[model samples]
Target: MSIVSSEKNRCIVLVGMPGSGKTTVGRDLAKRLGLRFVDTDHEIEARTGVKIPIIFEIEGEDGFRKRETQTLDDLTRESNMVLATGGGAVIRPENRALLRERAVVVFLSVPPPILWERTRHDRSRPLLQVSDPRGRLEELLKVRGPYYREVAHIIVEGGRGTPHAMVKLIEKELQALCEH
Candidate 1:
């Protein structure tokens, strides 16, 4: 299914867990919608010329979160784009407010087990570099899920559908929003 481009020209921001397919789905959705796509984490890496894990190692999570918030603030200012935000973007109230005010926030919901399965063995994720990555994933989900829901305008079940199908579901939801 295709989404008709409305004149609204809003940014679409995808927020979810680390392995919830935000970058992949956001890229496809942006392509389908004929908009630019920016993954905040990628943008951060590009701007710093260092990978996220390195940033985490050097600056720590608080420092990394500062960068994420700054990147999101910058990206949200652009129009007619799809942005895939870092998993922990919602941790900051300012980031959440900016996202809600400036974009159509989509929460790509995946189960903790699925997230663990998808993210395991990935060394790039600094937060998951633990003796108990599965438990860490579960802990993060429990802590962050409410923040995601609070900021989300649409909640898409990522585990149940293909990326294209998920995009279609998001489009349908956007259409419903427009109707209202």
Candidate 2:
């Protein structure tokens, strides 16, 4: 559980590339912290009544991004929750500001190789549906790393560790952040 120093309850927002274990870690961390867990992608799907791929197929990435921004704005206002954002959520500067100002953002740092290894067989990721996906992952990492860092209050390395272990580490970091 968290020991938030301030009176306001800030949400814990997890930002990272696909397969960086945001959803998994967010769920565990939320459970440990006695908070709700919300994944922006899943919540989008729930609200739209369509899968993200279908949204991407019909309306394209731009439309999906609009939805993502709306969802990010909405979710960031909710207190005492863990939010897992999509890989490209930070593409928009407004979303980055919302996350940074409204919540305590955690960037899950995983290398491109590990990201490829984790997501190679995942067909659901619209961005990685291209030739030379490993290269694409590296390109994305290069492009988005700065944006992630811009909003992150804590950066957790997710290259190694079980979800449970990662949750413990995040919990410790959250506690330490509270102390500071």
Candidate 3:
């Protein structure tokens, strides 16, 4: 599969679960491709001057999601960059539509067990802050997996490894896609 360099030059959006290393991999992918990288979560925090967890606390998930949708809409419309979206971004049909229209949506697939081991100690993720974070992850996966699959142009298996390695693998796959 060979992908045209022109097509590969379009925005590359990374979608995955909380601990799937989207942000980290997006940065490396962007660097390797000479494209700008934007993490929607970081953009939200920067634009609002508040962390995501704090936003969720003050405005609730509904408010946070609205902001997320707006931000994604704006970003996808304005730039040809690598975007790392939130774990739940694909849950909304509108978001999925926008992503599919504007970018090469890639799902960084990681097993639930790997996700649990990776995120067990992370306290910054609002969705994973529950008393039973592992259970919550499972529930989320069940609901979101199909949506992720539906939107993904490519799916990369991301195990417990450095973001650079994952990025390398994705780049290879993407290049192959272009060649075909």
Name the better of 1 and 2 by TM-score.
2
lDDT of residue 107 for candidate 2: 94
lDDT of 3 at 8: 31
Better of 1 and 2 by lDDT: 2
Once superposed on the true structure, which residue ranges of model 2 sit more than 4 Å away at CA? Answer: 1-9
Pick out the ten consecutive residues of candidate 1 with the lowest summed lDDT: 1-10
On TM-score, the candidate that comes out on top is 2
**lDDT digits (tens) for residues 1-180 of candidate 2:** 355434444799999999999999999988888889999999999999999999999999999999999999898887888999999999999998898888888999998878999999999999999988899899999999999999898999987788898888888888888877
Which candidate leads in lDDT? 2
Residue 157 shift from truth in candidate 3, angstroms: 0.7
> Tens-digit lDDT track for model 1 on 109-149?
99998898889978989988999999999999999999999
Off by over 4 Å in 3: 1-9
TM-score of 1: 0.94
Model 3 C-alpha lDDT per residue in residues 90-111, reported as the tens digit of each score: 8778998998887788899999
